[model samples]
Target: MAAEMSLVSVVLFIATGALVFFLLFLFAKRQIMRFALRSARKPHINIGADAPRELREEIQRRLTIVQSVRFEPTLLSEQVLEASKSVPNHYLHRMKALDAFTNAVDCLRSKDTTIGLRGTKQTMQLYLFTLCPSAANSSQAQIIDMFCSSYNHARHHPANFGNAELTNYMELLDKVIRMIKDNKKRRAAALYPAVETEVRLRRDCGKRESAETVRHTGKSNNLRLQARRNQPAASRPEHVEQFNMVDKSSGYSSTDHSSSGRGSVERLISPQHSFKPERDEAV
Candidate 1:
């Protein structure tokens, strides 16, 4: 279907063998993308070990919020994977994205800094993304320029950090991450209908029909064709002769021949023998 996933974490699975399609909604994709944009910008707060120990710790703690915001809580059972094996590449892509989300979250949780300090890369990005995501949807150059602009503004204006208190920041982070987790759960639930429907469709589309079943189905069709008639056998209509098949041995069809009425039949058989093609069988 060529459905784009760049707009959101909407991973679409276009069918290859049958009429079916599905999507995987990973909330992490958007955050991960914005994170990349923020990272690509040259200027960001990098509190090295030589910097004040307190400042480094604070920065590390705040980093956890960024990672948490990017976390994806989508964990499907093996059944979903097996049921959707037809699109292995897309399934694998979703798994890879999930893994990336996990790793990002882990790295951030290992941090000791609090969130929202002047000149912090992730702080401004997260706040901006949460409030205005269109800024990150631009080209790489534009996104980098936007990040640089935000960084310079925050560097001079400490209030630009959004929130700096440890408890308030954690609470706000918790709310944002909770919403993200809930959204992911809803997306995960949506997978069930697609998986179940595709599996059922595969069965209904007769992909697993046995050769015997196919033969039997064809036989039944032939029988139905045989029993069907243009008119009642007892009251056969004269016009019916136009549609009847001709005997090839006569070197002519029942129509477009000089013979009229039963003469056409006599061409295929002796006049002494009456034609009796109509038959019925107890189905």
Candidate 2:
């Protein structure tokens, strides 16, 4: 009876151990599945499209305020063409001087003078200043002419900018006129026989290209023109016009300086001052 009782105790201990082992296995399995699910789950994301309307509008208002406070012309394109021509970023500052010039009409014609008008007018005073024309852009004078026209309009259709905005504008215009005239005249004075006020445009063109480029450019131009002199005279009237200096005595004779001036530019560019010597390159 003692032996049987001892054997029963041993059997009961084994059964309890097995049950504990089974429970531990189930717990481990449950933990592993939870970990896997967490690993597979996508991360939570909150996109603007899913945002409330009020939040979106507040965000947009902040953007507008930031843009209005543009300390620089960051909104404009980087002007890759100018950059490629070795123009400097420093030249961009001159655009501020031209700002009022570009937006002369809008500055003179403040649409809503009663609300945010000072900011509007001040902004307009130099509106186009951010796009300072290159020296090659001969139309800088034309822009000033536009400003003068706007000034006339303001004179006739007068509105009050109580803080002397109009008065300030006139003063600024006078200053700009004097500054441009003085600077151009000073530049002209340095050259032989002085120079004409009409031809001197006080534009902020960048530094000169390297001397090698200038020398090669001259040689290339002479060679190219000599080649153009060789093409059959009347193959194209435009080409004939280009060589007015050389083709006038030839078959293509027409007294139209206007067509020659414009067409000559097109022809020159199309050739790049370096036309290939072969017919294939021309083709």
RMSD of each: 41.7, 28.7
- Clashing residue pairs found in predicted model 2: 95-129, 96-129, 98-129, 99-126, 99-127, 99-128, 99-129, 100-125, 100-126
On a 0 to 1 TM-score scale, where does candidate 1 land against the true structure?
0.17
Q: Per-residue lDDT for 19 in model 1?
A: 33
Over 199-283, each residue of candidate 2 has an lDDT whose tens digit, in order, gives 2233345754433211111111123223433546464233122212233122211223453333221222222221121222232
lDDT of 1 by residue, 1-283 (tens): 3345543333322342123321223446667877987888544545555788888888788876774554334444456546545653323323322333333334333441222222334544444333222222322213323333433433343432332222222222222232332233333332323321111223336566433221111111222222322325454323322211323234223233443443222232222222222232234
Indicate the worst ten consecutive residues by lDDT in candidate 2. 212-221
